[model samples]
Target: MTALGELQRLRASRGGPPRKRENKAAFLFLLPWFAGLLLITAGPIAVSLVLGFTDYNLIQPPEFNGLDNFNRMLSDERLHSALRVTFTYVLVSVPLQLACALGLALLLDRGLRGLSFYRSAFYLPSLLGSSVAIAVLWQQIFGAEGMVNQVLGLIGVQGRGWISDPSTALSTLIVLNVWTFGAPMVIFLAGLRQIPVMYYEAAAVDGANRWTQFRKITVPLLSPIIFFNLVLQVIHAFQSFTQAFVVSGGSGGPSDSTLFYTLYLYQRGFNNFDMGYASALAWLLLVIIAGFTAVNFWAAKRWVFYDD
Candidate 1:
């Protein structure tokens, strides 16, 4: 008999093929994941979408009021200020942070001694950057009688309250964001190691300088990594909440200068008890993030390179 006919005969001799039993077991194993998806993630998202169209305080039943929250956003001066602050933070900090990461990665890639220690030390900031403790520490460092002013005092210069100043409060948060460069630095270091040394050697033999080799070989090969970091950092910067919230004391205060979109959403939802408006704001932030990510992907085609 042919192999297929023999197999069919064996299966018929048995009750049936064992594939059904295996499939059942696999489904059983995946049940918890499916349950969590429906209960934890998907359920909240569905409810939030419904809540966005209604006006419901925590105390009252939802009253359907389509587009009012959105319309209010158009004329909300504070919301506009928050948008501007957020955009500025993303634009200014992401590039600076990436630059710092790339510089440090380059330094570390040169076969430095105590490489592990240095890498760990540098990466620690990223782990702690968003923590409330770090934010509070940052506040102390920039306060009127803080370390910054103390140092300036020794230098015969005056220093003001950096975090408390409306003009500079946002800048302090931006500096905090930039300080969390360790994560990207590690990624860049990995990307640097992946580059084949032969290409650099070939350029060197051709009398190319370090800058030339970097411009022609390193950049082209590393563009993909750079783009990856850029997209991730931009998204991360937009979603940043803890640093701003903790530093601003959950008020986004000093004339709303440090008001992040997420902070405003939190104020509306929890502090003000305006759940419906907060849901709308949450969806809006999602749209904004999605739009920026889409733009990054679209723009990446012109800059990002690959081996193939």
Candidate 2:
């Protein structure tokens, strides 16, 4: 028989096409994921969108308020402060963190002894950095009579409460953010390993120095990795709440110097029971992060290099 006739005979013998059975199996495997997307993610997102336009204090029915919550953001001084602090934190910490990561990645790429140990040790911070315990430990470390002050005193220098000073509190938080550079460092190391050693050898044959090789070969090749890390780190920084909440004692205090945008949203939602306004703030943050990510993607056309 012809192939089509044989296939039809096989299908008839099986009572249906095999594809139908395969599709049903695939769909069955994916059903749980689809359910989760609808119930856990899409459902709450849709509800939050609706809540953004209503006044709901969790104690009463939600009353539609139109654009009042968004309008209120225009004159909300604390909200503005939160925006400024968040922007400052993202801007200062990301570059410093990436620089530190890249530097360490370069050092580790040289086939150092016990490289796995070093990588694991470096990666531990990124894993624990956002945890409540780490934030609490950070708070203690920067306290007036904490380890930092004790070390300073050993040098005959008096150390004030770093987390209590409005001018310095944010800086301390920025330092903490930068210290979690392990994630990007691991990514950078992987990217570095993928680079062909022949490129460096070729550059050396042309009398190029180490800086020239790095500038001409390493950077262009690794630009995509750098851009990837940048986008992820920026998004992560924007959503940061645990560290600021814990370090600031859940208040964003010290004159609101460390008031991250998400922390303020938490304060409004749970603390003041202003769920409506908090929902609006959450949407606004969504817009802000989307805008920044879009900008980065648009800008990437000029810099990010693909092997293809």
Candidate 3:
């Protein structure tokens, strides 16, 4: 047979001009991601949506109901308490975190010796903030018998159990959030470096002092980055979980002082097996985050500057 005739024979045997083979390779490359998105992400999301309208224990088959879970949330006193606690946490932590970050970034912008080491050292806490070991360390540090009270004892200050005291427990978490300001600090450092040094030199020629230069040049230029960091830190603070969970022993104890929304949602869904109510709670959290982000974006129009 001629070469062309052989090719035709191969295609005939394969039942086409190899369209299936080309499709097979395409599907093979996409298989793992497809499976992961569907099974790992989309499946759970769809299940949660369905569960929001049902009564599910996760141990028993789900019993379908309409809007009951959401309606129950309206009068749930614990949900209100949790919302208040979470709002307090977000409002306190986000601004403090950003302020600390901006201050550190300003200090680092001075171009000092051993700069890289200092940068890495400062960022280390942020890298470790979400780790269980750090959470445990925080627990010990704020515990009644821990180092905080030890120093207080030496000075005759008589420090209370910071993590166990209802009034102080949430404050400890807020401090922890602020301590992890390193990530935003690094971002602000990058943003500061991107500002043209010529701007400062020109301001100097115009007889502007350091304070005047910063106000006229750096602050306006850095405002957008500040806004970006603010929005992200706000969202993260609102959804804070690990620190509160570990510190509060997952009970939101010391009179529910540390009962964050996510912690309460976990307790209702997984711990109590009330999946329907938990799903509704999760949706409510989504709405809260979305609303806050929208407000920030709307507010940014007035203040956040884009030099371009």
lDDT (Cα, tens digit) per residue for candidate 3, span 149-242: 9988999998889988899999998899988999999989988988999999999999999999888999899887888788888888887899
lDDT of candidate 1 over 215-242, digit per residue (tens): 9998888887898889889999999999
State the TM-score for model 2: 0.90
Error of 3 at 151 (Å): 1.3
TM-score on alpha carbons, each prediction: 0.90, 0.90, 0.86
Give the least accurate 10-residue stretch of model 3, judged by summed lDDT. 1-10
Q: How would you encode candidate 2's per-residue C-alpha lDDT over 1-308 as one tens digit per residue?
A: 22323543575584555443577888899999989988998887888999999999998999999999999999999999999999999999999999999999998996799999999999899998988998899899999988999999999999999999999999888988898999999999988988999999998999999999999999999888898889889998999998889888889989999999999999999999999999999889989998988898789879987675
Q: Evaluated with lDDT, which candidate comes out highest?
A: 2
- Every model: Cα RMSD to truth: 8.9, 8.6, 11.1
Instruction: Record all residue pairs in model 1 with backbone atoms less than 3 Å apart, i.e. clashing.
Output: none
Clash list (residue pairs), candidate 3: none
- Candidate 3 or 2, higher TM-score: 2
Candidate 2: pairs in clash: none
